[model samples]
Target: MSHRESDRRQFLKKSAATAAAVSVPYFLTGQNAAAADEQKANESNDRPIVGCIGTGSRWHAVGPNAMQLGDVAAVCDVDANHAAGAKKKVTEIQSKKGSDRQVDVYEDYQKILDRKDIEIVTIVTTDHWHSKIAIEAMKAGKDVYCEKPLTLTIDEGKKICQVAKETGRVFQVGTQQRSEMGLRFLQAVALVRNGRIGEVQNIAVAIGGAPACNSIPVVDVPSGLNWEKWLGQAPLVDYRWAKNGNTVNTRCHYEFRWWYEYSGGKLTDWGAHHVDIAQWAIGQSEDGMGPRSIEPIYAKHPVDFKDGMPVQDDRYNTATQFHIKATFGDGVVMDIKDSHQDELGFDNGIMFMGTEGRFLVNRGKIVGAPVDALKENPLPENAIAEIYGGSMPARGNAHMANFFEAVKTRKLPISDVFTHHRALTTCHLSNIAIRLNRSLKWDPQTEQILGDDQANAMQSRDARKGYEVTV
Candidate 1:
């Protein structure tokens, strides 16, 4: 067999071995106990060996969810505390399943990638580190399940897609709204595609604004944290930490989202979800089909910006209040604003207005005339499943389950990177326009800002030496 085929066979053998070990207790407990509780711990021997990287707060959820579907053999984090906590968490979870699987912990993620037995990996690192690790993991012959806002820059998105196509690995972007959230987002898409809303006119995505902060105090880096590794791909900087009375902020961990150097702020944080849903529903999700021009109506930054770059590094520099209008080639306008009170009327959801009617949908509820009409007129029985790309499973943590199922079937998961790139491209452009304080004409086919050399240059940043992502 070829080297790749050998790797695949080895992965299967290890997975089968792990599965059999976990099944011994279930077998001894009798068939009645197994039948009464099918918590996936007793279900199948087709488990894929999983390795979780970046076990921070977010991975606490993503990792545990994946443990339910796969055999988690390892957990890695740059922070020692997080790595230990994740090991404890994984051990407790496996204990409940009556399986004494030893989950190895690591400070360096490369160790996890080097393991040939690991068939799948979840990349829940900060926004900037995602592309590099994911690319490396795919190169290591493993499937990837990564959190959304997957790319730190537009160019990174391009690189990721190239690697994904070359590897033909099953990659799932964790935008749960597409698969979960009561399938409200799916029903919204179905309603639009079925012409229930007629020809689409405009979509308002209401992802709230980023928080502004004063210059944070530079302090000693915390013990058990690798500041250099955590700031991968981004510029080197001092660890900043401050507690203003009750509110605590830092240039590390969860607070990294506020810095432009590390993340795209709220634009990508929340925009990744709302924009993906809007683009998917309106059929602008494919490549070469996106906004023709993006106009920044209003933008308020926490710190002054000079030529699209933040002047101050110590403070939160992302846009605090912004309204970006992206007009497509077909004249359909997508308004991405901070909140509904910005005059769009919905706080944290999408509002679709078409020639025939309009509707709004968020996580909590889907409302408006079009949605209300669904009760009496009703969507077709197969409408939701068809929109979802297949039959839907029961809705508890179905996104990770979808990833594991794709691992078995060798099919792409619902939230693949291809369309996510398209949606994130729009969001990245919005940030560019706001930062530059100018309208930009875009060529989606070329993936560049037309007639604007400086804006096009902002599409990618120079990665710090030794952290650069090279194929």
Candidate 2:
């Protein structure tokens, strides 16, 4: 049978087995935000104390949702001014919304994490810091809502999941698209499972991974900035652009995406979102299992390799136009890459070609592939419930909203890490292929690349000292 058919069968089987394991939610997690705010302030259900690790634009993206969920108790940023600015914004929003909640400001994120009163923490820090801080927070008993791509390396991926399992903490990797309403993810995932599209064929995803951000010259580190701490793990480099009074040459905090040391580039940045949706559609995001084979099909080299893997390419290392193809055991081909050809989802979207028809889905929209498929939306039953193993969310809303709801009612959010892991595996695996530039076979159940020692080495990243993420 085709991969689609096999997956559908597996889904049905799993559904039968897990029907009693997960309880369906009544009205979604935490009481409505309006209700949450109106909670009588009876010492028992006062506002939830909230803290943040990073306060950039992305953190602002969830400002309203976070407010809906809890009070924005504190904001932290390495740059003193950045933290102050965020605190001001939070205070304004709270006051305007009549939240009657106080917001605090802190220069060090560790201080926020140290709090005993903090119920949930959001880590919007650089990618390098995600696993370490998140794991530490979970250890500290504060549930996390870390920004994505959740982990900087595959090993960290395993570590975070392992830690989460050990701690029983409710963690949500920030991929807001997972929470979008109209043209949501589940419809497409369900269609794939229901065989609305027939025997699956090769799938295509177009997303531009990190292009070179630019080779900025090194300069003096700005005042009030802990350049050493910012570099954290990953080799320490001189600070060039500290974003003080005027812009520095090029080096800076957010732009860290350009360098491999800090992030996986857009390969993991946008990949966090696009790759996530792709995984959900392909039914791969679960546990630590990965694709059957990964071929680093495309790169600029002189890139060193250790253990048969490429050494970190410091010069804008992340793939610019990397194209990777992963073939599943049952002949399902998944293509992931950056694109501009059409109005695809987040630089890329998931395109599935099956025996019956084809379907494409991304954060922005979910479109039918065949000309008539869009017209013939007459599937008999709830196709979503069929293929998703009845595990994904039944309702779609802001991603954080889902998480907050899940936290209260104890239901799984639409983008739980298990499934997202599968998606990230695809994204991270594509990196493995581009870096190694070789066809590598994999044993999904075992989660290892076979035969090729070189490709296997890229499975995990070598984190810098003091930043090693341990399970």
lDDT of 1 by residue, 10-51 (tens): 434543442232221111123342222235445656667899
Q: On residues 1-471, what C-alpha lDDT tens digit does candidate 2 reach at each position?
A: 766567656755554444344344433334353344334422356556788888766777655567665777888888776677788888888787676677778876778888888888888888888888888888888878888888777777777777878888888777766555453566766576566777677777776655453344566766777777776767777665433355332445667776666777667888788667656655556543357887665654334555444354334555667777787755677777666354434456767778887767665667766424646665545454433334344243346655665566555555566666667766676777676567777776777778877667766667678766766
The TM-scores, one per candidate, come to 0.91, 0.85
Cα distance off (Å), candidate 1, residue 3: 49
Report the error of model 1 at residue 165, Å.
0.3
Computed on alpha carbons, the lDDT of every model, listed in order, comes to 0.84, 0.66
Worst 10 residues of 1 by lDDT: 21-30
- For this target, which candidate reaches the highest lDDT against the unseen true structure? 1
TM-score of 2: 0.85
Error of 1 at 378 (Å): 0.3
Once fitted onto the true fold, the runs of candidate 2 whose alpha carbons sit more than 4 angstroms away are 1-8, 15-24, 28-45, 242-249, 300-315, 340-347, 369-376, 379-397
| lDDT, model 2 | 0.66
lDDT of 2 at 423: 72
